[model samples]
Target: MICPRCAASLTAKQRNGRMCAQCGKRFALDPAVHGKGMHDIRIRGIAERATDHGRLKITLTQLWYLSRSRNYAWAGRDPQGVPARIRWLVALPVAAALVACAVLTGGVLAVLAGAAACACVVVASSMRHRPGQSPHAQIIPAEQTFRDLMNGSWSAVYGGLPEGVVDDARPVPRPRGANRSGASVPVSPPKAAILCTDRVVALFLTANGIPARLEAVLVEVADADGTKGRPTVLAAALSAIAQYRSGLPVVVLHDADPQGALLAPLIRGAQPDRVVVDAGLPVSAARNRLGVVRLVRHDRLADAEQLRTVAGLPEADAEWLGEGFWSPLAAVTPRVLESIVVRAVERALAAPRPTHHEALTHGFLTWPQAPRSPRTSRAPGTRPPGTGTYKKKGTSSA
Candidate 1:
């Protein structure tokens, strides 16, 4: 391992006690003591990339995923086969026993030993033929393990977390409605709301003041128990915000999974009068894409039929999701995720505001019209066609 302070290659004896003999500087993390690729320098590089070179802030959970290798193991796949050296060790011993038995006793014992040796050889050959299905199954460390390493070794050595990394486990401060004197304070309604499925993603946005910058409210769909089912609480919050402002738009951000794909459509169905834009991690972006971390969960298998019917997803995407493959939005680099959310919110705010009936009928299919050239003359109290309907008191027009 290279010393983080001096960049000198240090052997185990030289770096004993976590002190670099060359530079005489103590380092926080040793690749040999921790895991491979877990040195301080490597962590700093990953942190820099995850935060876009200090342009954005990322949560500890996001940094953890960023530190992991891109290779992932799918569920239900066969584990890696036994090594050939171990197989040979067992086979050689069995063959020697069989030969000794044949030379010492030409009876049932020799036949039994020969059968045992043949069975051992056959099993070893079969196992050798079976290729390892998932060698990197245990590559990603458990969350708790990573947290302990970071909080213990990393913190002891570095004094704190790397730059631009915030602990998501800490409590986030919510907006207060009352003043210190106990007087009620009036607050203006937000222009839009960003509904996020992941708590860490919400924390990332809120910690970075993305919501305040956009004058938007951040609503996390997941509950305290981390359940990602129907977001009744989020729906009610959106309804309340919409009541405050009649046409408040909603931007939905979610993972690239079956439930995530359906989240936006479900919101649009519940809030038929508002424009709900889905800025989720699409399956297309994760499928077969390098450097994207894909995870599998057998307990939460996707229903292809449900995704196809509710989300109107393509057959290929639906099938891929149905197989229990999912990519987390938090796994995306912090800068990229922030950009995606910002662009989606802008689009939601700019979406055309149609009547309730038009919204229900046309939905997101409605596009904003191009600016029309100014007209020289028009009839009194009249507007151009396709602009909007105008009505006078006690009068109706078709």
Candidate 2:
């Protein structure tokens, strides 16, 4: 292969990480595509057509174990034997109900009637909660505005954290030891940093009524704080899990579309402790039910296709689609903004606004006028106590 940018011959690259030597620009190439030259005889076979051709395949034994032992279904295949699984599942309760009813009603007729009722309940519950039911078949429940604000829209709601999610943010306190004799010592107050994208997420916590006292506000503000530096804006959202009661309810409110689907999981993955209630439109009648609904965009939104795509999202993807969905250039329709405002106000009513009001107020971040003080002759990077930058009378001049 040749480097597209620099027109230099591309050499064999490392696993999954490709490079453009001459231009120093790198593009990830399919791992399967490497070493298999386009002109190679192997190119004439089925390998060229496979979507996963770049991925290496494991042994059949491993595949079987993943499928059966762990009860995992491999990608690209609908779950097999779902009907049988459902019927078998439905049968257990049906039989139990029939036996119980017979004893209660004192006859075979009673047993048959009870069996019918049990069958109905089993069928309804299984269909409602079954794993394999296509997402399209699911009905979304209405949401309340207050609930949406309190719980947050789906993509923003709390949920499970991936392993090592908060490892980087964990505070590492300095050790205690002897000091005056030139020995190690313990640090006071213990410094720690809570990484976040900006003050927005932190503010969101306060808006939802969580305290911002030193308790959760340690230090640092960034999108991420981890071994791998993926840019994001919700490092401390995990703390919201403890602030809000566990598993009360969470609604993911976000733009509906592909990007939204991908973003919601990132937030959910960071907080493994809380349960995400749902992802969907958070209008007042949508709470307590499946909360998946399309966001109402603002008027004259430039990206009609994007807006349309988001609004047209299927219901089953409420969770996957609601995470981190942001489009800066897109104009949200007035209707959408109104809906958002309504939901937010409703939620705010549910709980008193979280602590740290200054954080939520934008002007708090506006640069403060320099404190007035006398001029000093100190050189750059050196200033005596109480030296201020602003002008004041009766101070030494340079």
Candidate 3:
């Protein structure tokens, strides 16, 4: 294994886990934490996407699982055959209610009763509460947001990736009516970096939130061209370096794979002069912290070339990644992905507002300053009686 610190090869003769003969740095990946026992971890490598903590709106992946976990018309094509047990919980009751209503409540009442029972069953199925588990973090309805972000409209009939979804590769086409303004508007340079590892992710990120004619704050590195070390990445790398030189923070959103891990490093290599914080795939960072990678049976696994690319990872992590399967960055639902992007932007913007001098010397990040309106302040150019602001309506005091 090459030293992550020095990038030098290591001989396999060390007996102590702490010893590294090349760099001689004793970095222990795993450290025991005190729990009920001498506890090490609650989650070792990510379990095979196997149901962890969560609640509410789902990702495309989550929807796939939820569909498979039950047997119903809506359970999708569960080719794996949902366990019969799931039916007893929902379908069985609905069916029983239908039969009972047919016997007791003759007329349209029978159908209504059955429909009511089905609705109740659906609600019951969705109310997932288990001991020691937090409800899945609520997100803006994942399926809807993704659909809207992709097509810039939430009118999708279903919560799935639709064909011809607009993305970085396919931006919202300018309407024929858009030329009504006559002359073209000059394009503005992006103010911040929102790096995404894939085209879909970049499209979704750009498409999410208020639809704008132009996205001035978002500079995208939609690594859509597949290979990481391509001329496209070099273009993105150069742009990122340019942005870094201009004092804008680069926020990278990547998959939790070896290439994803390499993104920040690659950009950092592009501009060794400036500092760029890797707002990371924290799990990947966690893996680096412990020198381990979690293996999961993701519905989507990395292709052979991707797997081979990460194959040079340290033995333990490479084993975890190479265990015949892998997950995509899409494993992070659209909602969570949005939250991560927002936080990264917030962190960058939160850095002390640079002074004019700093703007000239260190370069400046452009951000609109917020208005400082006191709670009692009236709307600008509006003033009424007593308190130097508009008086409350229907109040005795002026």
Which digits, one per residue and each the tens of the lDDT, describe model 2 over residues 23-132? 77554322244322221122212222221232321221111111110111111213444454576577767777766777778667886777777776676456532244
What C-alpha lDDT do the candidate models reach, one value each?
Answer: 0.68, 0.30, 0.39
Candidate 3 has a TM-score of 0.36
lDDT of 3 by residue, 50-133 (tens): 222231222333322222211111101223434445645667677676768767977888778877777766765555432232
Q: Return model 3's CA RMSD, one decimal.
A: 28.5
Q: Give a tens-digit lDDT track for model 1, residues 20-52.
A: 999898988777777666788988999998888
Better structure of 1 and 3 per lDDT: 1
User: Backbone clashes in each candidate structure, one number apiece?
Assistant: 0, 43, 4
Looking at candidate 3, the ten consecutive residues that score lowest on lDDT are 359-368
User: Using lDDT as the measure, which candidate wins?
Assistant: 1
Off by over 4 Å in 3: 1-190, 210-216, 225-235, 239-245, 273-275, 283-315, 322-325, 351-398
Candidate 1 at residue 359, lDDT?
36
**Model 2 regions more than 4 Å off:** 1-231, 251-260, 266-326, 341-398
- Report the CA-based lDDT of candidate 1 relative to the real structure: 0.68
- Residue 174's C-alpha lDDT in candidate 2? 20
Taking all chains together, the TM-score of candidate 1 against the true structure is 0.69
Instruction: Sort all candidates by lDDT, best to worst.
Output: 1, 3, 2
Local distance difference test, candidate 3: 0.39
